[model samples]
Target: MEFKGKLSLWQRIVRAFESFDSWTAFSLNESGRRFGAAYARYAEAMDLFQVRGAKRVGVEILGEGLTLGVGGLLVMLALALPAFREVGGDDWLKKQDLAVTFLDRYGNEVGRRGIRHDDSVSLDEFPDHFLKAVLATEDRRFYEHFGIDVIGTMRAIAVNARASGVVQGGSSLTQQLAKNLFLSNERSLERKIKEAFLALWLEFHLTKSQILKLYLDRAYMGGGSFGAQAAAEFYFGKSIKDVSLSEAAMLAGLFKAPTKYAPHNNLPAARARAADVLSNMVDAGFLTEGQVYAARRNPATPVDRKRETSPDFYLDWAFNELKHLSDDGKLGGDRVLTVRTALDVSIQKQAETAVESMLRQYGDSYDAKQAATVVMDPDGGVRAMVGGRDYGASQFNRATDALRQPGSSFKPFVYTTALLTGKFKPTTIVTDAPLCIGDWCPNNYGRSYSGSMPLATALAKSINTIPVRLSIAIGDGNPKIGRARIIDICRLMGLTTPLVDTVSLPIGAAEVTVLDMTASYAVFANGGKKADPFAAVEVRNSRGDVIYRRDRDLPAPKQIINANVIADMNGMLVKVVEEGTGKKAAIPGVRVAGKTGTTNAYRDAWFVGFTGNLVAGVWFGNDDYQSTNKMTGGSLPAMTWHEMMAPAHQSVELKPIPGVPTTPGGKDAVASASGPKGFEVAASPQRPAVLNPRALDAIGGIDSMMKSIVTRRGPSAFLEPAAETNLFGAARSVGGRMALQ
Candidate 1:
C-alpha cells in the first residue's frame, strides 16, 4: 500500500508538469523570443527619434502651443457653462409665461405688466429714422458684426480709458437683448460670461432684425412701461408708427437709462439725452447735421401727466396673486390674461393720501419713517393697499411683504383660542398679576397689574400677563400646548405668516403682515366666515375667454370660526374700541371693533379694526426697526385708521358688525341692563359726554375732536382705569365685588 501511495503522488506531479509545459509552449518558442526582441528594439528607436525631434523644435513652439490650445478650449467651455445651463430646452426663448393687464373694480385700466407677445411690432413697420437712431445710440455696429462687436468694444474701451470712467458700454445690442430676456440685473463676472454666451447663441439662431425687434419690444422704458410701443403711448400719447423724428429720438434715448431720463419726470434731462442721440446719429453717418439740427432745435416734449398717480403697490401685489393662480392651474395655462381686480381706485387714493398726509404731518415728530395700511371688505376682497409713503422710493410692499410684531393686536387670537375652548368667556374672572413661566416672567404694559378683572377688560387694557396665564390655563398648565392652539386658530382665521412657538407669543412676539391681520379680523366682521384675502375677481385670456372667475372658480368662504366664539370675541373687541385702548379708533355712530398692539420699546404700533362695511389695519414704524418716540397703537395708527375709514363710510350704506348691537340709525346701541350676559358694558371716561351727530358731518370734524382729546390728555387718555365703570354709573374696582347696573 505504501508503494502504491508514493507511485500515485509521483504520477500526479508528472501530470501537473505536463499540463504546465503544454500551456507554456507557445510563449517559450524561438519565434516568440525573436518577436519580443524586435518590439524592444523598435520602442527604443522611436523613443530616441522623439527626443531628438523634440529638442530640434523649440519647446515653446511644439509643447506650449498644443497645451495652450487645449487650455483655451477648456476655459471657453467653462465660461459658457452658465449659458448651457440657462437654455436647457427650446422654451428658453419664451421670456414671460403670462402677459397681464390689470383693471380696477370699475373696469378702468390701471396698468399693464408682463410682456404681451401679440403686442410685438415687426421691424418692417419701424421707420428708418427710428431704427437708425436706436442703432446709432445703443449699438453703432448692430449690423456690421456678430453678437459681440470687437471693433466697437475696443473703441468703447479706449474712450472709457481716456475719460477715466464708463462713458460708453461695450455690450452689443444682441447682448443687451440676451440679458433682458434671460438674466437679471446682477453685475458679476459669471453673469457677464452667461450674457456673452447667450448673445452668441441668439445671434446664431435668430436674424438681426428678429434680435432688434425683440430688443425694442422687451426693454423697460420707465413709468411702468415696457417696450417702445408702450413708451411711445405713455410719453408722446401716440403710437410708435405715428411718432415724428424728434419723438423717435427721445424714445430711443430712454433705452440707456429710462428712469433717469423719463420725460414726464425730468424733461430737461430727457431733452439732453435726446440731443446726445441726435449727435450720435449725425456721427454714425445715418443723418446729416442739418437733418438732425431740426430735432435738436425743436426738442421732443412728453405729454403732461403730472396729476396721474398709478397704484403701483396694489398692482404689484395683484400681479403676484395672479401669478400664484396661474401656477396652481386655476387659469387654464393661458399665456396672456386680462385681470379684473377688486381694487377700488377711490379707496386706494384715500388710503395713499392718508398715509402721505400723516407722515407729512407727524412723521418727524414721532421719529417714524414709514407707514403701511390695508383695506378690505368683510368678504376678503382687498379694496385698497398703501404699501408705503411713496411707491417710487421703494417697491417693497410693507402691507404684504413686511412681517411685523402685531403687539397686543395679536392678543385677540389668543382670546379667540381661549373662547373656542368653551371653558372661557368674555367675563371669566382671571388674575392679572406678575407671571413667570420657567423664569421667563412677563409684565403688564405699565409693569403694574390689576389684581383681578374680567377676561374682556384684560384684553381691552392690553395686559401682557393675562394672555400668558390664559395660554397656560387653557393648555392644562402647558404653555407650549396653549401656544400651539393659538397658532392653529390664527392659521384657520386666514393668517399665512409663520408664527413662532414661544412663551412670549401670547403677547404678539410672532411676526405677521398687515394684510393678514386685517383679513383675520374680517372673520369677526363677517360673522365668523373665512376671509382669505383675494385681489383678482376675474381673469380672461388674450382671446377674451374667461379663464378664471372668483365666484365660479373659488370655493365660497367657509365658516372657519364657530358663530358663538366669534360673537364672544367680537363683544370683547367692541369693548376695546368703546372704552379700552382702541378708543381713538371709534366712530361716533358706527359700531367699530378692533384691538391695539404696541410692541416693546414702541418699535411697532398697530391698530386693526373693522366696521360693518370696511375692515382696515394700520401700522407705523421705521423701516429699519427703529423705535418711535413713545408711539402707541392708540396714537397715530388709530388716528390714521379713523381718518381713512370715516370718509369711506359716507357714501355707502353702513352694515352691522356680526355680534355687536346697533341702533336703527347705524349707531351702536346704548348698553342697558338687558344687554348680553357675561360681557362688560362700560362707558369710557375719555369719550365726550355728548357728541353732536351734526358735528360729525363737517369736514375734519372727527379728526379735530379726537385730536383735541388726545392732545389734551396725551396717550394716557386711552389707558384702562383700575376700576371699571359700568354703563349705569356703577364702579367695579379690580379685586372688588362686581357692581351691577
Candidate 2:
C-alpha cells in the first residue's frame, strides 16, 4: 500500500509479492527492485517525465512496480502449474478413517487381537446444520468462493510483511480444505500453487452443495475420528442429523484445534470455540438472534470419552503368524485375513498371570527380563501361550523362538529309544565309572561314580553315564537308538534343529526348542502317539468363508513306539518322580511325569512336564545366555511348572502314561522288584562260572561283602523279577564285581 501510494502499476505489482514463503518471492522482489532502480536511471537520462519531482518519480516507480508484479505473477503461475494441487477422485472424497487394532487380553497379559470396522455413518445421511456450523467455523465462505481466497492471502501477506520480513497464511475454508484433501500444508511456492490449482479444480468438479457436504463429512472434528457424522457421535454420542444446536456448535468448534478444543480434552476451550462459531453462524444469517443470546448464555457441552485401545503386542504376534500362514497376511489376493485360534480367554488369562507372576518372583535372581511359556493339551492343541513378560517391552516371542539345549531333558529321548529297541531293560547295568569321549570327558554332577548301575536307577537320578552307555547299546549296530536316536526322536517330534549325532546327545548335548520339548512329552502322555503342536485352529476369509481348517482326524498320532515299550519307559520315568531328580515336579492327586534339566554351569534351568490333560514347559535363563544366580532346573523352573499346571489340572480328567502299569496287561507289566541291596556280584574271569566258586574266590572287600549278601538273602531278594535280562544269571552270588557294559 505504501508503494502504491504514489507508484504506478508495475511498482505496486512488485510490492504485491513482498510477503511470500518461497525463494521465488524474494527473487522476484529483488529483480523488481533492480529493474525499478535501472528504470529510474534510464528515466533520468531521457527526462521522460519533464516535470520530474520527488512525488512524480516515486509515483512513476510505484506504477512500474505494480505492472511488473502482475505480469510476473501470471508468468510464474503458468510455469509452476505442474506443482499445483490436482483434484482428488470421488473415492478419495468419501473420506479415510484412522486405523485401530484390537487385542485379546488374558489376565495381565495380551494375545493376538484383530481389527474391526465401526464407522457406521455415511455421506448422504448428514444434516444441514452440520454444513452451516462447519462453514461458519471452518470455511466461513465455503459456498461463495473458489478454492483460494485472494483477499485472505493479501491480508495474511500484509500482516506477515510487518514482522520478521516473512509471510504467513491467511487461507480461507476452501484453500484450507484443499490443502488437507490434496496438497500438503507446506510453506513453499510449489505447495501454495498446488493448493490454489486444486482449490479451483474442486470448485469446478464439485458443486457448492457437494463441496460443503464433503467438507462437513471429511473435515477432522477431533480425536482420531474422521468426518462429521463420526465426529457427531464421537463428540456427543449422536448422529449429525439428530445433534442439538449446542452440540452442533461444539462439534464445529473442534475445527481450530480438534484435540485442544475437544470437549473430551478441554471443555473450556471447546465451549469458547463453540460460542464463537455460534456468533459467526448468527452473523452469516444462518442462526436466529435469540439463538445467539441463548448460546452465549448456555455453553456448549463436551462429552466424557476415552481413546480406543490398541492391541499393540497381540496384534504384532498375530501379524507374524499371519505372515507365515497366508501370503503375508493376505487371502485371495486381498489384504484381509482372519485366524481362529484355541485361545480361550479364561485359560489364556490364567496362563498369562501364572507366567508373569513367575517372572516377577524370579526377576532379580534369574536376571531374566524376558520369558515365554506354552501350555498345550495331550492332543497338541495349544491352550495358552505367554509370549513374553512384556510384549510391549520387547516384541521377540521367546515361546515360539529361543531354541536352547535341553540338557538332561534330552536324556528321555535316549532312554525311550533304548526301551523302544527292547535291547536295554531298566534293570540292565552299565558302567558308571570315568568316561572321556574325544575332547569331552563328561562327569557326573559330583564326579562320583556308582561303579555299575541299572538303567532305571541311572535315569531316576538323571545320571550322565547311563545315557552314553544306553545310546551305545541301542543305537550301536542299528545307529537309530542312541545319538542317531536323539536326532530321529527330534525329527519324529517335528523339530527343525539338527541334533548332535554323537553319544553326547543322551546327556542332552543336542539343542531343542521348548515347543518341541513339550510336544515330545505329549507323545508319552498321549499313548506314544506324536501329535502336532499347533496354535492356529482355522482361518476364514472376508466373506465369512472358511478358507482352511485344521485336520482334527488326529491322524491316529502315528505310533512312534510300541505300547509296552512306552509303558516300560513310563514306569522308569515314574521312578524319577518316586525317588529321583524329578520329585519336586509331583502334583497332588493328578499323576504327573516329567524330567528336570540343568545345563553345564547351570546356564539354563528347565522343568517341562505333562499331566493327563496338559503339557507345559518352563525355562528360566538370562538373555546374555550367562549363568543365572544359582538357579537350577529343580528351583524356579520346577516351581513355575507346578504353578503353571495347577490350574490346568483342576477340571481335567487325567490319564496315565500309555505303556505304564496304570492298569494290568500294560506292556511295562512286571512283578515288582525289591530295593537294590547286594544282589550284584563281581567274579574273576579265571574262576568257574558257578556261583559258589565265584563267590568263594572273592575279588575284593566290597565284592566279598556283595557275594555274602546275595548268597545269604537268596537270588529273589536282590533281583528285579520284571527285569528280563539275566546275562549274569549263572553267577548271581559272585565275589568279584560283575562285568557289564
Candidate 3:
C-alpha cells in the first residue's frame, strides 16, 4: 500500500511535468535533466530498435525516451481537454437572456427591461481614475505582453514553488480579463492553460485598445454599478468624464472587493484603498510623486445621493406576477422573455419622493432604516413600488419581504370578513374595553376606547377592541370567521406569509407584510374583488411573441366580501381619512379612504388608502426593526400617501371603485376616473344585503360562543372545541351565561 501510494504520487508528477511538448515542459522535468544529450541520442537509437521490434513492438532504449514523452503528453492532454473546450459559454452560453430591469428617469417602469447584453465602448469614455489605477496596479506589462508572457510565467512558477503556495499571478491583464469575462471562478492548472491559450488568441485577434475596452465594459464595480461608466456614476453621481482622480482610485480599488470598498459603505476603507491605488500609479509612472501626493491629500467628495432605485419592489411584484405564468416556476430563464409591467413613472416618482422626504426628515433617529410603498390600480396592477430607501444598500426588499405588525390597518380585514360571511356590519355596536382570550390581554394604541361605539365609528377612529369584538360577534364558533383565525383570507389577498393568530392579533398582533395587507385592501378598492396585485401586465419574448400573459381571469378576484358591505367599509375608511387617524392621508380634491396602523412597539407605521382611480399603501420603519423618531402611521406614512396620491389624482377625477365589467380593459377601466354621474344605488345592480348589526351583536363580541373554532393566537394553529368552550365559559360567566345565550 505504501509503495503504491509513492508510485501514484510519482505518476501524477510525471504526468504534470512531462505532459506539454514545449521546451518549457521539458525544462521542468527532473529525470529529463540528467538524460539531456542521451535523451536526444536515444531518439536516434530508436530507429535500429524499431526494425527489430517491427514484428512485435519491443521496449527498446530509444522507445523508453519516446514512451515517457508520449505518455506524459497524453496525460497532460487528458487533464486539459475539458478546459480547452471553452471558458464560459460556447454554444450554450448564447442561450441565456439576463434578467435586467430598465426604469424611467423618475424610476418608473417604461416597459420590459434587460436583454442579451451586447454593448461595448472606447476606453476614454470609460472614465474614472479606477481604470487607470487598475491598469497601473494590475499589469504594467499589459501593453507589452503578446498574450502569454514566457518570462512572467517563469517568474510566477519560481515564486510559487518557493512559497509552497499558489502565490504567482503572472497572467497579464489580457489573461486576467479573459479569465473573468470568459472563465469560471476556478483555480486549476487546466484553467491556467486555457487562460494562456485564450489570452494569446485575444492578443492576435483583438487590438490592445479593444482588449482594454472589453475589460472596462465587463468590470464589476460595487454599489450595483456593473461597468466603469456605471461605477463613475454610482460614486460621483456624474459621468465618467466628471470623475476626479481620488474618486477614480476609489472605484478602481474596488476590483478587489466591490461591496467592502463601495463609497457608500465604509468611507475609511474606500479611502485607504484609494491611497494604495495612488501609490501603485506612482510606481507604474502613470502619475508622478507630486500627482500622487496631491491625490492622497485631496479627499474624495461625497458621492451625491443617487436617483433612488426600486429593484427590490419591482422584483417582488415581478415574482408575484411570475407565479401566474411560470407553470414550472423559475425566472431569468434562457428565453428572451419580456414582461410588461404596469409601473407609472408619475405615481412611482411621487411614492419615492414621499419616502425620501420622510427619511430625510426623520431618518436621523431611524438611521440605516428603510421604508416601502406600493400603489395598485384597483384592478390589482401594481403601478408603483418603492421597496426601501436604498435598493443597493440592501436587497432585503422590505416592501414585499418584511412581515411586521400591520398595526391597526389589519382591523379592516377582520371587520370586512364579518361583513361578507354571515352576520356583521359597519353599524354593529361593541364596547372597546378589556378583552382577553384565556389569559392573554389585548389593548389599543393608547389603551383607551369609547364605551359603546358603532362599528364604523370604531374602525374610523381605529379603536382596537371594535375589530376584536366584531370578529368574535360574527366569526365566533367558526374558525373561518375571525381575522386572526383565518390566514386563508390573507392568502386569498396574495399574502404569502403565515399570520400569527395571537390574542392581540385582532389588534394587528404578530405580523403581516405591507403587500399582503395592501392586497387585502385591493379587495375593498375593487368592490370586494381580490385581484392579485401584479407588476407585470404582459410578457413578450425578444421576438415580440407573447410568452406569458397575466391571467386576469384565473387568480381572479373572487367576491371575498359583499358589494354593499364593501361600500359601507369604504365609507368608513373615507371617514378614517376625513375625520379619523388617517387625516394626513387626505387629498385636497381626491376623495381618499384608508386606514392607519401603528404597532405597539412603534416599530412600524402604515397608511393604505384609495382614490377613485388608485389604491396605494405606504409603510415606514427601520429595516433592523428598532424604533426611533417615534413615527406613527398617521405621521410619515399618511403624509407620504397624501403627497403621492395628491399629484396622482391630477388631471383625473376621483370616482368610486369601478364595478366589474365584462372585458379586461374597457369602459370600466375608464370609469375608474370618476363616480357614476347619475347611477342610483337602489336602481343599480348590487349584491347581498348586509347582515342586521343589532341581531349579530345579540351575542356580544363572540368571545364565548366561537373562541374554540378559530386559531387561538396570531394566525397560525387552530383552536380545539374544548379550548373554545373553556374560553367561552369564562367570558359567558360574566353575566351568569354566555353572551350568545
Candidate 4:
C-alpha cells in the first residue's frame, strides 16, 4: 500500500487491470477459487470510479470493461435458457407401453413374442452387487457428478483427441437415461447439446435411484428382450435378484453393446468384455481380486435357447382363439393378457419328443419328411399337440392345417353310419370278395380277402372293399336312405372337410384336417357325443380381470350316434388294436381302440387311436404327397402313437374300451384264411351271426345276387374261395370247418 500511494489514479487502474489478468488465468485452472477472485477484481475495478458524476478516465475505462464482460455472459445465458427449457419430463416416459405375456395351463410362462417382463424391481429389491456391477462397468463417478462429470469429460476428450476419433464416451448415468428416454442417437453437436440439457433436467427432477431404474427398464437387451429382467431371463435364464456376482458382471457388460456381447452370439467377445467388468468390480471394491479371479473361471452360461421353446402349434392355435375374443381386436398391444390353455405341458413335451424321435429314426428311411400328433380328451380339450417335427423348420400346423386324405381312418365313420342305421352289427357277415360299381372297384390292403368274414373282421383288417360297400349301401340316394348320408354323419361327428358324393368316399378318398379327424374319433370315445376340440380355456387381462372364459356348458354336444352303436364300434375297434392291424398301438394294461390308414400309394400313413382316458392321432408323410418306402400305418404311425400315448396314459388308470368284453381269460378269436393273420373274428356260440343280403346287394352293385344266395345252403353266397387259408380260417362259419383259436 505504501508503494502504491505515490502512484496516479491512471497508474493504479493499469495495475488493477494487470492483476485482473493474473486472477483470470488462475480462475481458469481452479474452479473453486474463481468466484472469490472474480468478485475481488470487480470490487477493485469499481474503486477506480469517482463518488460524483464527473468520473476520471481510468474509472470510465474500467466501467466499460466490466459492462462488456458481464453483458456478454448475460447475452449467452439468455440465448441458452430457451434450449434448457426444451428438456422433456415424465410425459416422455409415459409414451412407452409395456408388452404382452403368455402363460401355460399351470400358470408357468412358456413363451412370449413381444417385449415381455416381470414386475418392476424397486430400489430396495435391486441387489447391491447388481447395482455395483452395473455402475462399476458403466460409470464409476455416478453419485459424485451433477448430470456431467467434468474430470471424466476432460480425460475422455484427451483420449479421443489422441486416438483421432471417439474412443471413449464421457456420458454420466443421468445422461444415458436422458438419451434412452427421449433423445435420438444422431451423433451431431446439436443432439449432444440437447442430451446434456435433458440430462441436467433429469438430474434436477429425479433422484439418482430413479434414473438408474429408468435405464435398466428401458435398455434394449439382445434376442428381443427389452428390460433388465427380460435380459436376465433371455441371456442367463435367471431373475435379476438371483444373479450371482459373476453373472451380474457378464450381464452388466452387455449394456455397452447388447448383441455384440450376447454370449450366445459371441461367447469369446462376451467373455473378454465380462473380464473388464469383473476387473472394474474389483477396483470398485464390490469384489476382491481373488473373488474376481474365481468369477472369471466360472462365468455365467448362456441361456439354453431350446429350453425357452414356445409350443407354437398350441400357442398359435390358442392365439387364434384369443383373437376372436379380444375387445381391441388384437393381442398384447398395451394390455397384458394371460391365456390359460387346456394343454398338458408334460404330455405336450412327450408328444413333441415322440414326433421328433420318430422323424429322426425313420424319416429318411420312410421318405417321410414331417409328422404331426394330437392328443385330446373325450370332451375335445386338447391335451397335447405337435404340429410338425421341427416347428422352426416349418410352421405349418399339419395337425390342424394340412387336409390330407384320412385313408382307412375314415372307415370308422362309415362303420359308425352303418351301425347307427341298425342295418349292420359288429357280428354281421360281409362278403370281402371283389366288387365293381360303374368303373370303380375297391380291394383290401393287400388285394386279398377273407371270403365271408364278420363285419368286425373286415374292419380289424381295414378291408377297403367292405367300407366302400357299406358307404354305398347307406349313402346312396334311396327313399329310405338320403344321398351322402355318411357325409352327414361325418359332419355331425365334427368332420369339417368337404367330401364328394363318390363311391370311393367310404375308403377316405376326401381330404380332411387332423383336428377334424381327431374330433370325429372322439365321438366314439365319449359314448357317441360329438365333442368340438378346443385349445384355450380362458383369458385374463393385465389387471387380472377376466376377459373371457370357455363356456364348457355352451353348445352342448349332440349325441350323433346311439350308445349301442358306439359300444359296438368301441368293441370292434378294440379288436383292431388287440389282434388286428393296429397291434403296435396296444398298451399292455390299457385297452386301445383305433384304426390304421395308409393312403393310396402310401402317400400318408396314419394311426388314429384312443385309450380309456384320451384319443390321439399320428400322421407321417411327405409334404408333396410322394410315396413312402413301403411305410404302412401300422409300422411308423402306430408305433409313434404308442410312444406318445404310452407316456400320456402312464398316470391314468387302465380301463377297457366302453363296450369291449374285459372278462379275464375270455378268449377273443380271429379267423383268416387268406394269410397267417386273417382278421376274422368268431362270435361266442350264444350270439347270432347274421348278414342282410339285401343290404349287401345294394352296396356290391350285384342285383339279384342276394336273391340267388338264398337258394345256396351255406349263406356264403357272395363269398369267393380263398387262394390260401390260415388255421383260423379253417374254422370259419361261412364254409370251412376250422377250430376256434
lDDT of 1: 0.82
lDDT agreement of model 2 with the native: 0.64
Q: What TM-score does model 1 achieve against the real structure? A: 0.80
**Candidates' TM-scores?**
0.80, 0.54, 0.56, 0.55
Q: What local lDDT does model 1 show for residue 36? A: 92
Give per-candidate clash totals. Answer: 1, 30, 16, 4
* Residue pairs clashing, model 4: 671-680, 672-678, 730-738, 731-738
Residue 667, candidate 4: C-alpha displacement in angstroms: 20
Which model is ahead, 2 or 3, in terms of TM-score?
3
- Candidate 2, residues 679-728, lDDT tens digits: the string is 11121112112222123233333444556656866566456553213324
Model 2 spans > 4 angstroms off: 1-112, 118-121, 126-324, 328-340, 359-370, 418-422, 469-485, 497-506, 509-512, 538-548, 551-557, 560-565, 662-741
lDDT for position 713 in model 4: 34
lDDT of 4 by residue, 249-292 (tens): 78888888888988888888888888899898888887889877
Q: Give the residue spans of candidate 4 off by over 4 A.
A: 1-109, 113-312, 327-334, 476-483, 500-502, 545-547, 551-556, 661-741
Q: What is the lDDT, from 0 to 100, of the residue 361 in candidate 2?
A: 62
lDDT of each: 0.82, 0.64, 0.67, 0.75
Error of 1 at 247 (Å): 2.5
How many angstroms is residue 335 displaced in model 3 relative to the true structure, after the best TM-score fit? 5.0
Q: Model 4: what TM-score?
A: 0.55
